[model samples]
Target: MNRLAYQYVVLRCVPRVDREEFLNVGVVVYCQAADYLQVAWQVADDRLRALHPALDVDQVRDALGFIEGVCAGDGRGGAAAGHPVGQRFGFLKAPKSTVIQPGPVHGGVTTDPAAQLQHLLGCLVG
Candidate 1:
């Protein structure tokens, strides 16, 4: 299989932006040639609580769910709905000042974007 270029961003949870602290919570991977865009996430509740006991884990999960919705082009994507894979990815990776945000964009080559997503999620977020 021919390798294809892919772009990705690590999803981060900034419990306190003022302190410039964040927790890696997920990953978004986009492989245009493969028509693939997806996310793999795992919220470490204990770790997040250690960071900010007042932080709402449910809310964080909800934000992550919205990302999943955007990837699927479903109702959860809200204004991002109806967009193609690349556009959806752009929306997800856009800079934001919120509890859930994306890290810097990165690139790599992959034969399976799905597997790559998992690996990155583990390496970067897990």
Candidate 2:
């Protein structure tokens, strides 16, 4: 199978930004050449509570849900729904100061981005 260039970012939940602590909640992969974009997420609630017992995991899940919507073109709340795959990925990967944030941008080559997304989520967030 021919490989295509891809870029990805680790989705993080920073309960507290000042202390710089975060938990990996998901992975977003974008393969421009393949016109593919998707996200795989596993919310470690126990780990989230470990960071801060008062942390609101539902809020995190809600935020992540929007990302899932963006990837699927579900048009949830009309956020980045009609944009190109690359633009949608750009919107998802943009940095934010809120509870859910994206880590540094990273790149690789993959023949199967969807499979690679699951693999990365398992490795990074599990």
Candidate 3:
């Protein structure tokens, strides 16, 4: 089997309230450096759930694409529901600055998405 390299971005929103609600309003862009066929959405529902307990899994799952595209700077659509209007939430300003250094993939891993994305890119180019 031919191994494929993929880059993914996961975005999320955390309400600064007592409940600590988490809204998954981000996207994951996965693509093979050589071809777009490998392109896919990693989505942020699971990540959001892992990060925050107040989020509804169903709603997060449904909004994965919208979140992913917006966060990835694809200019898809509006902000996540329930968030303040006109609030721009994303990490597209400086993607390279968010890259995480790879240490170990397993054994209580704590790899950040930006770093993972950069690592994937490096694997494709290196």
Candidate 4:
């Protein structure tokens, strides 16, 4: 069976309207497969603030290989050919388009933790 590895960075920033609250900032590296998955994420805080931008892009790409190794359980086997990390990770998804934006939608398949985790893992192992 052929398995694939995917990775992407999620950059979150709190708009000034929120008074610059520390939101989920930085990138997340995730590897998924049919049966196993692993994710490593680093946040940008005071000590690691400066590294945020560069790390966001570079780490995310580097993470594809790292995550593949972790999922392979041997730290080997490079990324598969033609993997769409951004789309798979929702990076390319357009933001919710609505003239009158409603509050955060609570009821949704994406909000399910177990399902989300399972999907993530499946992406790494499959």
Candidate order, lDDT descending? 1, 2, 3, 4
Shift of residue 44 alpha carbon in model 2, Å: 1.0
The lDDT for every candidate, in the order shown, is: 0.92, 0.90, 0.37, 0.34
What are the RMSDs of all candidates, in order?
0.8, 1.1, 11.8, 14.7
lDDT of 3 by residue, 1-126 (tens): 344454443333442335444343433333334222111233345565566556666654444444444444454534432332222232221232111111111211223434454454344322
Q: Which segments of model 1 are wrong by more than 4 Å?
A: none
| lDDT tens readout by residue for model 4, 63-101 | 344444433344342432124443333322224221111
CA lDDT, candidate 3, residue 32? 32
Question: What stretches of model 2 exceed 4 Å from their correct place?
Answer: none
Tell me the tens digit of each residue's lDDT in model 2 across 3-114: 9999999999999999899999999999998889999898989999999899989998998888889998886726587788888988988989999999999999989988
Compared to the true structure, candidate 3 yields what TM-score?
Answer: 0.28
**TM-scores, one per candidate:** 0.97, 0.95, 0.28, 0.23
Candidate 2's TM-score reads 0.95
The most accurate candidate by TM-score is: 1
Q: How many clashes (backbone N, Cα, C below 3 Å) per candidate?
A: 0, 0, 5, 12
What's the best-to-worst order under TM-score?
Answer: 1, 2, 3, 4
RMSD of 2: 1.1
